[model samples]
Target: MALSEIPMGQIRTYGQIGKAISCQSAQAVGTAVSKNPWLILIPCHRVLPSSGHLGNYAVGEDVKCFLLRLEGLRFDNP
Candidate 1:
């Protein structure tokens, strides 16, 4: 699956995944990602805001931050 292809320690934007599936908006991709039933398997944690800021996550922004930190990802202020 597309999510599985994303490597660990790497990050992707919603728009990038949207383009991969031919979706027009990153919002659309965010919707699909929010509904992903297999969170761990899909690795939605790897996705971040296009502005390089961590956005709201289904599990909460705190959790998102935790996951990103666990992966050693650093983000600059937007």
Candidate 2:
């Protein structure tokens, strides 16, 4: 999965993942990501919206923010 391909400390937008898999809908990608059962194993926390906002996760947004921050990613607007 493209989610697995996202390097640690890096992030990808939903549209980017969709494009990587040849899917045109970012919402579809978001849906697929939300359904990920592997959680951190797949690094779904690394996926965000095109607006650079932290989108929904199977886990809470706080946990997602925590994971991303732990990975050395900082957010000016977070």
On lDDT, the leading prediction is 2
lDDT of 2 by residue, 1-78 (tens): 799999999999999999999999999999988889999788999989988778787778888889988999885434
Return the clash pairs for model 1, or none. none
Q: Compared with the true structure, what per-residue lDDT tens digits does model 1 show for residues 1-78? A: 667789988888999988887888999888888898887778998887698888777788778778877889775435
Q: Which residue runs does candidate 1 get wrong by more than 4 Å?
A: 76-78
Task: Report clash pairs, candidate 2.
Answer: none
User: What are the candidates' C-alpha RMSDs?
Assistant: 1.7, 1.2
**Candidate 2 — which residues are off by over 4 angstroms?**
76-78
Worst 10 residues of 1 by lDDT: 69-78
Scored against the true structure, residue 32 in model 1 reaches a CA lDDT of: 81
As for model 1, its CA RMSD to the true structure in angstroms is: 1.7
